[model samples]
Target chain A: MAFFRSHVLVCVDPECLARGAHDVIDALQDELVDQGLIDEIQVLETSRIGGCEDGPEMIVYPEGVHYVGFNADDVPFIVEEHFLKGRIVEKFREMPKVVVDEELGPLRPKEVRIVLKNCGYIDPTNIEDYLAVDGYQALGKALFEMTPEQVIEEVKNSGLRGRGGAGFPAGRKWDLTRQVNDFPKYMVCNADEGDPGAFMNRRVLEGDPHSVLEGMIIGAYAVGASYGYVYCRAEYPIAVETFNIAIAQAREFGFLGENILGTDFSFDLEVRVGAGAFVCGEETALIASIMGLRGEPSPRPPFPSVKGVWGKPTNNNNVETYSNVPQIILKGAPWYASMGTERSKGTKTFAVGGNVKKPGLIEVPMGITLREIIFDVAGGMHEGRHFKAVQTGGPMGGCLTEQHLDLPLDYEALTQAGSMMGSGGLVIMDETSCMVDIARFFMDFTQAESCGKCTPCRVGTRRLLELLQKICEGFGEDGDIEKLEELCEEITKNSLCGLGQGAPNPVVSTLKHFRHEYEAHIYEKRCPSKVCRPLIRFEITDPACTGCTVCARNCPVEAISGERRQLHHIDQETCIRCGICVQVCNFNAITVE
Target chain B: MTAPSTERDIPALVRAAIEKHGAKRDALIPILSEVNLALGYIPGEAFKEVRKQLHDPTEGVFVAESQLHALASFYDMLATKPRGEHVIKFCENAPCHVVGGKAVWDTLREKLSLKNGETTPDGKWTLVTTSCIGLCSVGPVVLVDEDLYGNVTPEQIGDILGRYE
Candidate 1:
């Protein structure tokens, strides 16, 4: 039992948490504990393993074998046969098993792995799993070994920008606060992520809370601050739970409280729950919310770095930004700066969602192409459906057409293509989708979540919504399209915070890419994709329907009527457009015309 | 009770909440949400109990009703087998009612023979609509205990409730 061999580590990040990490953890623990070989067998639950499209992910430590999208039912065989009995779990393994010559250690012929080395290979919740792969060694180095100026200098050299979408220099932001004429300054981790389809913060917080905490402590040292705050959304109970646990554990381990690592520097962190406000994601509004004011935006001359959070010099970074701090401290700046594109350095985390073959969180080098993600990494669109456009940057982000699929996803490139890497929310859409409707859908989301503090965002977005409604409802005016462009410009220029400024991007980009579809909606009263109910009609193909009685019985509006063994016809006028009939019908008879 | 005339001091506002309703965790949700809206987050000492000054031990008055529900029959999930004293679930999604989900829900209310969000005199059942229950697919879905009932119907509603009790 004490005889040593190789080890296997699997990441159980929450995204994959649902996919089957719990069972994996349970199995690994049980198997090891049962034989009393628990001390010899090392299993880790690291952060998300990044095979969202094909993952209930696992990794083999010492050997570095990766299996993507595996089920725990496959674990026993993997442990007994692959690890112990000397056989591989072929069905569960992610890629083709490479055979080693027995002389050379098992090595991948061609595959690059960084930024996610610890992901899926260690237990993120356990500090020991993190430390086994050398987690807090970075904090120990930065705090006990390096000077504050040197820590800042190393980060300045890393070229890691704020992953919260703005891509500001992480080191410089710390440096500014460090040089500022302020005492009792604060370092904050911005976990109040409100994007509709984004959960990167949740993953980092739940899977690797210590990363962000370690980052914050280093940031506090660099900024000459004594306190840190993690403003997380109260909606995310799991994230909050893990963060609370991480904080208590870190403090208990002598990492977060006064004089960390036996140094004179003292730093403490507190978790503030946000009452589900979307606008509070904005830095200024977040400060206001923390200051016991409504989470509303105010004009800024005093940025948070200058006079923020109780009017003190504060360094605020997204959850991902904080997660990177321990890395830079451990790996050194040059190592961190080595990855990613020129302007946007290091790997970026993307919540790849929607109509893609693989819809989950992925962390790749900054300049990775959308084509590579969708076709290669994400395993292409689901069913090979004609890939239309991908919407990056949440509701406020713009949609890029198929032509731009090859575009590198850097901060500047995405913005130039009509979407910034706003919090890295990538919602991929397919051919069956209507771009006009997609634009309207995102606009409706933003309008509802808008704080309504400024006129342009408040009123202009409403007017724009009314216009999109007019277009979608088949009542668009001839000049309406031009006015939408005008309104977008006005709203962007006049709105107070980033929400209003970027709210119009969805409309503008969709219009730019799919204007002909809008023209069809106006001139021909036709929905090119035939998706809009008002512009299309459902008909039972005479030859296909066998009068099964399913459609006739299921229609909410009683739109269909048919006798047994007779053809069914839809009463168009009575139809409420519910489409229940279509869904209930197993036949190919129902067609939208 | 009605948000303090649109402008009030923080503690006075909390006191006003206490006047309308006693300090309690069950009371905490509505009172805290309102207070947080008026002022971001509950103040440091806001958790302190509010004492009622209007009625002394010498005299007593009838308790105030929350009146959260205008039409009780509209809530179907409330009518099911009365589990606890009340049914409290928030709707955190869209299109619950747009597809006549609300109307279908109302049928459950009528079947349960109760008004919106009212407990039976036995203090057994109270049904209420919420902001958005996140499971949109099964939406207009009701969560009774840990179980989620999706695409609910009035006829089937009673059968599910029978098991809960």
Candidate 2:
């Protein structure tokens, strides 16, 4: 109230929009105008007010009062009390408050930030933010400055490969796509991040949309194409919005319109948002999804480059692949190719997640050992827990045990072992996490996300899930393992798309490494980790139980029967194996075994 | 945001272009992007303005923002604002409502400091709740401006906004 009374600024971010921000803005603005207070206070539409946790949140300037949890009915109250009346609405204040400081570690990361270098650093909504950070410098170099053949040559020199789970050379893919004889050729950036625990593409889009755009434009120049599409998942609203903003911004700038940067080349980019389906990441299915059809995979004789995206010659690469293009061109083939193993060059950005100490985004040189990435860079296992296996590259990617920790994390090195670089999702696992359960979790993810386009991927992923769910539910037979193993191959070969083929990866990797866990679930009829709730029984031991009634009341099912001062006992019949009782007893009174 | 393709008005366009973007002839990224977005293309008319905005263009070292290849000028989008017909945001960061995201929903109720079920009274903005925008590195994050706003606070919320009609 110091300057000119109180100011109420509404949150207009997607978080707010989803929660009725638009309505709030509309109602609040009108209320202010109708109340004739427009001149006294200024209601400006600024950037996001950090506390998304306090969604549909509004901040009153000068006073700085936070309001939270508003029903539509509460809008008038907020406006009247907070805005018109200048009274703070205490009931709507959000907790623990969030503040944004520029001094924080890294907005887009400084070192090894290759793919995401410009995400947060630039404005995806403004094309200028992109160009300011050398957005299309590489495109300029590749297009007006260099020939298409020269661009491909630089790619081959860089040794950058496809990031779409396949490790094919990006330059080679461009070469193939370019070789394909057709008009109306197309270039697509696969923003479909289907891998479980993988959101690297979404991050890139949210952070540096123009990087992807610049890469696509360069790729288009290389492949002799005029139109490009980014097939992103609808679940990736931020990425979608960012790309949309980037396109508009680019078009507004000279980068995307006719005669980009004073050159004869013209490229227009449109975004095609995908249904939240895991299988759609596969090139063929992605093409289908882009064409406004069901995301089903077709045979790959011609591949997407020869015939794809409405039967036009197309080059399909995931967001990362396209992301690498501008870097290669801008940094030069030699500079880009300087890192990694002999075969695999450039840095790969991995979404280090799961039971890891530092779960974020890390970009490692290609040849860097997995141990370096996991232990040195990722800060090792969570809470110093004993290292278990890590599930890499999503469902199609296999789990690597401790023995393979030293393996080089390049294209061939990973494939040589068990895992393929299926995108860049790295989910960490600890001792407590059951290997079979992890496999089952992935199977569930794939099964639920399957498009049901082909019999093998649709039915096979479901069947595998059914078997795992059965095993976890305590109905597993010894022979089920063999059947699951066999079905893995059937799905791999029979499925039309990569999704079906890769669905069995988690199961196979787990089986190859942690078969004992499965055997325990089957033959022993016990879960080693005690995580599979149905198989394990929780009980309080007489020796360990300390006559403390703590566990008795905490048990939601009242499974524990105990007197006030005597040793407690779990009613075996009522025990749910939920592990809450075990967790409650600090004295180690309860045990799964 | 959509416009029909404009035919070149070379002299006027170039004049405007020279006036606005010619100052930092080496780098006319940001303003050029804005003007280009407005005018569809940079014309010679803006060169004089450009020369004034970006001084010392003869050195061939323009501010990176003044260049066609400047990164920010191309991939420019605000991360902390609502966009589109309807906005559905998820809190992808960890430590957010204990991963349950119920509080995120609660916050959604009060988004833009506006209450749930309340339209801007103009049918312009709609709000939705999101759980985990998926960047766990920054706990309690919100994806606005196409950006990962880390460690969000409920206090600065009203500041997040857009002029979108």
CA error at residue A310 for candidate 1, angstroms: 0.9
Of the candidates shown, which would achieve the greatest DockQ relative to the real structure?
1
In terms of lDDT, the poorest run of 10 residues in model 2 chain B is B71-80
Candidate 2 deviant stretches above 4 angstroms: A1-111, B1-133, B136-165
Alpha-carbon runs more than 4 Å astray in model 1: A1-121, B1-165
Provide TM-scores for the models: 0.71, 0.68
Q: Give the candidate number with the greatest lDDT.
A: 1
Can you list each candidate's DockQ?
0.07, 0.04
Cα lDDT for residue A107, model 1? Answer: 21
lDDT, candidate 1, equals 0.71
Per-residue lDDT of candidate 2, residues A1-593 (tens digit): 44667666677778877888777667766776877876676665654775665577777778777666675567777777766666777788765444542221353322376886765566677777767777788887887779999999999889988887788888888999999878899988888775645677888888788888888888898898889878877667777887888788778777887998888888887887653455667788778666544456788887888898879999888888888888788889899888878998888888776666666776777877777878887778766577787878866788998998988888888888888887777776778777887788678667766767688888888889999999998899979999999999899988876777778988998999999989999888889986777888876777878788888888768888878768888787888665657666889878787
